[model samples]
Target: MNSAANSRMIEIVHVNRTFQRADGQMVKAVDNVSVVIKEGEFVCLVGPSGCGKTTLLQMVAGLLEPSDGGIAVAGREISGPGRERGMVFQKDSVFPWMRVIDNVEYGLKCRGVPAAQRREIARTYLERVGLGHVEKAWPRELSGGMLKRVAIATVFANGSRVLLLDEPFGALDYVTRHQLQSVLLDLWDEGGAAARRTVLFVTHDVDEALSLADRILVFHSGHLVDDLAVTAERPRSTDSLLLPDMVAIKHKLLAHLGLEKRAKPLAIVQDGAAS
Candidate 1:
């Protein structure tokens, strides 16, 4: 393992977040959660709907505050959003009024990166995401998948150390989802081991988590339930899930979601042929 992988990047110490309901009830969205993620690590937060996975991710992104405890990234406590973090939501984050290249350049522009340099950076990432040809196109002109690619390129161009993705591909079709996942993985791995950014991806799909995560953190009813390490080698595929270790992890995750995989019935055959 590299030195970056050994250094702690994110620390959540006994964090808790709660919200008051209109009915005069207080609900704990995240309860006493604590975890440490190393620099360059890809960690997935997974749980069923309303299980507080997203809530915990938002706290790390500085979009929401924990009612108690603290979250520190790179040793500094996070009070609000910062340039060190970039978040991509499930919804389309591309600006309809801006051209694709401009959308990708927006973050750089905000940080006062020189126009020429930022434009070059934006173009580079656009090409990386396979959107170089559509740089001049408006968000409204692009398909849903294309728009998502634009959003992704934008965050990478901004050069954040930590990437917070909240089900960014959840709304896409299966094929598109798989394609986007590959795109994300390619970009993430492009920087090589030493330059890799820390990623905290929140997803409800167990397969998605298994495919991308170096570590999987399971949440249930606003509490951290399971923390499992995935030692499986990268460039994993659908068949990876069939491995004994991966299968066992999947079973545990499904059980947390109140689900169980059923055994497939064997097909009848006669004389080694279908009946």
Candidate 2:
């Protein structure tokens, strides 16, 4: 709640990631990206496919290393994976062998929480994500949406202060996606006072960012193309897209991604056809 926390959670300073293609060419998946996300901010990394949005989020999650520069959280360098940074990937990363409650408590157990306490914590988080009744259900038994809820519950239940999500709900249907987005907002509520968890969400969907993010960082061609602030008020829904501010943000993102719709000049079309 302090002024300092109104900004500055995760800092990616001049970060870069490079890879060697099968053709023996060096490609920079991410290039010289510098950004500081505010604490408790719902920030989205928006961009086209292969633009390195996922690469950057994985770096933040410590699942991948930056080839140059560094990423730090709360002033400490991110050397490797830490318990404080939790990640939810695009696919449902649930353990198919584990039941819903067991999956939720998996992190807690790994961290050495006591048996009874871990179970209670798992149940609590399951309830939080509206899957309490399915605690004993297997992963295969649940629908796609339910599996994602289990993954989300596991991340939050682990008490991670920085949530790094790479299209966590990307596989769900429209109805399920909206439902879970609202659920996430309710659970992430300013992250509370003493323990505010910051979120860095990666998505190519403009409407998703508009509905969920406080800021949208547009990534393209392995670079940070634009940084836009979503001024829309919270408790936001897709209806906010009707607002001029939301429309402008969407336009900016599309234009940056080279996805903007434009009118074709009649002269050019006629000349090409004639030729």
Candidate 3:
């Protein structure tokens, strides 16, 4: 395939997801969505609760099959989980019993990578995420931010070309969240070949989505209500130029939830003046 074709890392074609409740009613979580995620692109899914942002991520991760349509990564259909994609969920899914290095090596070990090579890879990624000093620390010994760093290092060590982040920083406090975001961006930039990893981040925080995403996809009532490209330069800072767009998108999303008055001007005004 040409470079242009190779650039498309993921494709969602006419996808729909519906679940039958025990009460015999159908709940559609995603509706007729089609999108293409290019290689190295950072895409975020954001919307109100119950819009199926997480469900959509799960579908792309091949954890759940769409009720209709298809999802493909690197031009191949995704029927099941594979090493091509690594996922970090809302919770720190690390094994509490395992030390930090052990958790980072787990995936490589499962894949039959030699112990020496796995350790080397784990060390490299741990250092990349600023966790090199805590190689022997157990999950319980680490702070929430530290644990999240370990989880990120673990996933990156697997050498996956696509990353599925389901609100990895959702539970962290403001300072911790900002710190992790910076670390994530640095790692994403420094990964070199791995740097081309296409990322699909799901978050309810509009600021987080706006700050990190190359593009943002808004979900409303199981349908893709908006696909907005973020034309800002890389290493994005949280600034007024971006906030208005984010707030505008948030308001548009709110309207889909039957809320009135999209975009709170007072909030925007205060934020802008403070900046």
Native-to-model Cα distance after best TM-score fit, residue 273 in candidate 2, in Å? 51
**Residues forming the 10-long window of minimal summed lDDT in candidate 2:** 266-275
TM-scores for every candidate against the unseen true structure: 0.92, 0.91, 0.88
Worst 10 residues of 1 by lDDT: 266-275
User: How does candidate 2 score on lDDT?
Assistant: 0.83
RMSD of each: 9.7, 8.0, 6.9
Q: Which regions in candidate 2 have their CA more than 4 angstroms from the true location?
A: 1-7, 190-195, 261-275
Better of 2 and 3 by lDDT: 2
Native-vs-model 1 lDDT? 0.88
lDDT of 3 by residue, 161-221 (tens): 8899998999999999999988888878775644567899999887787788888887877
Reference-based lDDT, each prediction: 0.88, 0.83, 0.83
Off-target runs (Cα >4 Å) in candidate 3 are: 1-4, 191-194, 240-275
Residue clash pairs of candidate 3: none
Candidate 1 lDDT over residue span 1-275, tens digit each: 34553487888888889999999999999978878888989999988899899999899999999999888888778999998899998999898889999999999999999999999999999999999999999889899999999989999999998999999999999999999999999999997877889999999999999999999988888888778898788899989988999998898778777786534322211111011
